[model samples]
Target: MAQITLDAPASHAPVRLGRLLTIILAGQFMAILDVSVVNVAAPTIRTDLHASGAGLQLVIAGYTIAYAVLLITGARLGDRLGHRAAFQAGLTVFTAASLACGLAGGTGMLIGFRFVQGVGAALMVPQVMSLIQRNFTGAARARALSVYGAVLAGGSVVGQVVGGLLVSADLFGTGWRPVFLVNVPIGVVLLVAGARTLPGDRGEQDRGLDLPGLVSLAAATLLFVVPLVLGHEEDWPLWGWLMLGGSVVVFALFVVAQRRASAPLIPGRVAGAPGMRAGLVTIFLCMGTFGGFLFSVALHLQGGLGYSPLRAGLFFIPGAGGFALASLNWRRAPARWHRPMIPAALVVAGLGYLGLEVFESGGVGFEVAMGLAGLGLGAAFSPLLAVALTHVAVADAADASGLLVMTNQLGQVVGVATFGTLFLSVAPPTGHALTVTCVALAVTAAVGACCATPLLRRRG
Candidate 1:
């Protein structure tokens, strides 16, 4: 177990604590909210810009790609630069990027700005968890984590709703632009509040950036991700397959390089930790299903059911509300509950997927399917996170946290690329494709549940 450092006695007044926490939470919510917020707006963007399917995918994937690639580097930068400086810088960049996204005149510009926005988000997000870990201890830390978990779930739900509202409102006749523009006000407030309130942690400033490792990792990811993302669009050409093969080689090279590097980007020991390994694998599977489900469902509601974006957004509210309630209560639940809860949640989510499959033929049962999925997801989300981080040492906490989130993003990218390709390949978008995808998600959930069995048994 990593030794825990007691926080330096807080000098701030009691009233200031609330403001500090709020500022931190607002920053956290803003970064996370942007992840899902773009989904509902995709159709509007497509219409507004006359984008092809490939163009639309680029808009979403570009952000995720940038976000994933930069996250670890961002965290390390925080450790080097002082969390407060990194946080403020990230917030400023994120806000400016949001404005650029809003004013973007075409698909290419918007996608580029989204990539920049993601870099800002990557820079900002790690600080939230790091700050919480640094400032709080024991029960306080647990409580703070619970709150953060709720914020994560809540932000995702709110993103969908907010995107819907913006698209539906078409404020200032800006259509999809408001989805990006809405962040400006929120970002400004967060930046100002963070500047005033967030404490600086500048203790570890001597560590050097791992540029070599960063290059290798980025190259490896591009090799793999480019193929997965663009393969279908380009009809699985020879170069795509060649790139996929090269990704394996590049990944091997990356592993070797990291092992040899004087200052490794990702410490070999941290990545090799059994607990971290299991946790990341679980996150990958869980989020893979999650990313695909959200993308497909949004499309289904809009394309298949002909629901307005607002109506589609409304459908996700129950899930979000349920997630918030469950996350808030998560810490209070028994330790034994932790072992079974994640698997049970996966089972529940699987059942929801099954429900979706059964109800795909009709419009009337859509809400019921969504509700079941939400309840299951809400119950499982926090528990999975708690379980994943259960064995992490405090010193490695930041690294472990970065890995967990990176895995989640990677899962989403792969899920969207692979499953989306499957869905699109069926052509003419049919209920059958939805049914198959739902069943596949159910199967994925079952696999997650099976993996959790050992965890539950060991805990028992």
Candidate 2:
């Protein structure tokens, strides 16, 4: 038995990593882009569609709900249908749905189309990491993961900026339509390039779809997320609470189904891997804090401080800049620096967040704090992925990738909902709200840092 090196292709001689990453990341970038971009365009959408409050909320939340619900199943599909095929198919659906979203005549139409777009995204996203797992090993894989992590961090900020610009530009009097339409051309280009560049499956075929596990999982996710996304908007109706309770039961059943199924949606051994398990928890805390921090800051800046959408969006740039700088060299950093990076990132980010609480003015102080937080974000993301996948078998990579992504999404939803509740209930001043959120974020980062301590002791 010998170690598999990234230089040695597992399938057909390895596709060029550069080309592969470009095509795969293009699709993922679009998915991540849509997540934040819609928030910027929400007002325009409501006005144009004459949407009611409930309808407006759906317009924003539908895509996320659908995207979250289908992710695990989508990863299984990739394993079964083949990654290249699944990737292209998902993009095609996504592109078409994006076009439909742009042309949507009413709120209902927009919400429906967005849900379809999410399904497409779910099908496409898992393949990005799974393919990276198949195509590259060790250091090359580390670099590729670093690139992916950077895009994940930067793409959200890009969405903020681009969304603001597009809405404010009102390009061709299309208003919010461009936010959705923007994906159309990008999807077309990626599809064509991806077909040519992405690698095929590495001799593993789908071992049959686990329908029971999938249904239970989807039901659980739907139940869990619906309450989180809609509860606040709808004033926490009785049904919302019931759904939340039901989600736990459904999830328990899903676990039971997985234990019994011959071909489980998630392989138990992969989930059981010690490092992977810890990584998943750390990822949840990291992403939950990240999501809550972003939402809280955006609300505070816009609602409390009276900054316009464009200005608030611009405010996030320094952080994105810091993330770019750190992630660009993440893979090149020394091995000894790798494990220490997560806790260091957590400490840096926590301190920077504290600065956000203490700083009185918005000149150099704000930028420095943001930059530090951004740098930590990138550093933290890079190692988590690298370490989580360290022990995953190639056959289980897609499942692992899907689970990791799903946890991140769930964390985001939980973070937003929970912190948002506190934000609303406190009725604090702008500074106080920001401080509260940042304190929570700092605590979360610390927890994540503790979880990541295990990485320091892990050996090849």
Candidate 3:
């Protein structure tokens, strides 16, 4: 394969185009995989690293916070420096951080490394979407987007299953370390493949970094995420409340800073766009419920039902299949279906949850109900993503992409907090609490459906 140099045009021949897509998609798979893989490994990590409940929560929250904070900046940088350069640089950072995570000695070390890994992921993730817009056009671009959505959904399911297998296998007695170590071989292959196949940077050299906006945004995220993770563990301490309050203030300040900054981290016009605004809100609700459902389901299967991690992961396979099927046919689906699909998918997902609440006895019926939830999720996510990004301008594509990613992450954080809090507040045994959590999650999904209906109508 010929190396694609910095000066090459965006066009690709049929043969090379296949390689380009492979390189881009591989990077994307790694990014999405990181988000959910850790859930399966959390128990092992807690046992091995002697992580407290709080420490375990940080392991997840830290990564998400760093990833969310840096995403917009990463997108902006990509736009300024060229998507390919940003993508490669991001991949390199992510690979190194994964190794750091695998080698870490304690909970603190793992949390720190995870944060760094998220920074790299943030840098790489936005580039994936930007690359699609840059490299493909018209129907081809739409096709690429569909593939991207499928990969996103598929990667999440694969993460849980793969993490379970790796943990259970305990290859070389490394236990959960395999979850992080596994990325190295994959990353090496991606790097070599990307070097040979990815398109080069297309932007001019003079674009500068937005340091001030980056700092404020990071501060704002820490204020928001740190409090959420700590609040429940500490029984909502004063500092937690203070941090939550401060987050609002810092976010307000960040908004003011962005308005004044010449090179804002998030372009104001893009943020203000009606489609983007609706998209971000929709993503927040959808991802929040999705994230909570996954977390709750994992706990239900493992903690409540006493299933092994591998078995728990297997339960999600049907749902993953359903999502893949829906995504494959999404293009052929009518545009009118788009408006109603959001609510419909939510209703299905909610009913799946309701079924769990009503019929669950830790049996085959429970697993079937869970699969239905996945089917609903699959039906909802791709179409929703398409609707969200539909009206974004090409020039602001990277920024818009970053914002969408941020909302998704934020949704996960909020979901975990809201649902986790509800489950914990009951102070019941693990099994009962999980059941109640599923019910609460079902109700939340129903609310999401209601909110999404208006957006669908607006889009229609």
Candidate 4:
């Protein structure tokens, strides 16, 4: 098969970075929203379909399982097929799956459809970063990356808002179904726009897909993600522990397979990029705190404070807003400041958590605390990503993208497993549990700040 390098866009067609980013980002928003929106609709779904507890759990976990496991494979496919083709195909599958989920008459169907939806997300999401890395340069790259990070962070809040609104509005008395159906029109529009505007590579994949590496990696991801995601719910059963232990072996096998492959899924240059390890650690800690904070906070709000689901969801809007504002504009700071910004901003995030602990009573103080956290996080993430990718050749954009995204998903799972468990283990007095959890999250942020020394620090 014929192929061109990442630098070679198909000469037959024009590449519009602006148009392409818009379409791809829209798809990303939809995919991330689905991850959390379903939580708001689960009770209604149970009532509608008389789902057993296990079925409801499956409906949620199935998508996560498929998505997390297949992500690296999806990224590799994007590299081979061209990001545009992979993204479009993923969007098609997701849109169709969303419709099927909305129309499902039973829990089993919804569960199956949700997994298909995740498969679509896995195929599509890695391309967002790959495309940005390929098309944008200098300040433009920074800005595009900022917007990508905002969309990455903000999608969960928006999902909660949209899901709550749809359920509460019960549009046409469809209840929870509209949450799924709402994606249909948006997806259709993106599909059409993307087809017309997104750039494409002009050739076929040159090498065979890395089947051994793919299987090993998939197994490794499942072993880590499944145990993290379900272990808490399962009361940390023996099998989950075994899976966790087995993951080390699978990961070792994957690393060996990747090294032996003629065309590896993750190239060594991309993996060895300067600041790569620190970037991943920062991303992990950032996402973990956010995940654990989101989960435990929501529970505390609803059960301890007697807030409605919508209210609890809406409370997060301030954090999302602050994050977007910070991410979209923070690159204007001086070069000298960039090295120190990550740790400084993360310290701010730590302070925000502490402020929340103090102002747990609510009102402007609480909102302010949330916004402060977002501000710090948003300021840090984009720069961290930029610094991380500084040495990664554009040719290996897909590999960098896949690595970052996989690390992010892993961080969230681990965060939920640990912090969420702490929040749940305390009997009654959820306020106390929330306080304890917040303190722990704050401490984690402080550690992240210490750990997140950008490679630029040495240069500066």
Tens digits of per-residue lDDT, candidate 4, 1-460, equal: 0111122244322235566777888888888888889988988999999999878988988888888888888888998899989999999999999999999999989999999999999999989988888887767777778888789778888888888888999988899999999989988988898889777774237856788888889999899888787777778899999999999999998888888899777778777777888888888998888888778877888888888789989899888988888887787888788868898888888888887878887789989999998888888888888888877788888889989988887787688778999999988888788889889999999988888965546531
Give the alpha carbon lDDT tens digit for every residue of 326-373 in model 3.
Answer: 665666778668668877887888888777766555677777777777
List lDDT for all candidates, in order.
0.75, 0.84, 0.78, 0.84
Clash count list over all predictions: 0, 0, 0, 0
User: Which pairs of residues collide in model 4?
Assistant: none
Q: How many backbone overlaps does candidate 1 show? A: 0
Q: What is the C-alpha lDDT profile of model 2 across 1-460, one tens digit per residue?
A: 0112234355445446667777888788889888899999999998888999999888888999999999998888898888888888889999999999999999889999999999999999988888888778767788778778778777788888899999999988999999999899988888888878777654356487888988999999999999999998888999999999999999998888888899888998899875888788888888887777778778887888788888989888888887767776776677788878888888888887777777624667877888888888778887888888898898888899899989988888888888777676666687787888788888889988998888778755
**TM per model?**
0.89, 0.95, 0.90, 0.94
**RMSD (Cα, Å) of candidate 3?**
3.7
Q: What residue runs in model 2 are displaced by over 4 Å at the alpha carbon?
A: 1-15, 202-206
State how far residue 343 of model 3 sits from its true place (Å): 2.4
In model 3, what lDDT does residue 363 have? 73
Candidate 1: where are CA atoms >4 Å away? 1-18, 50-53, 272-274, 361-365, 427-429, 457-460
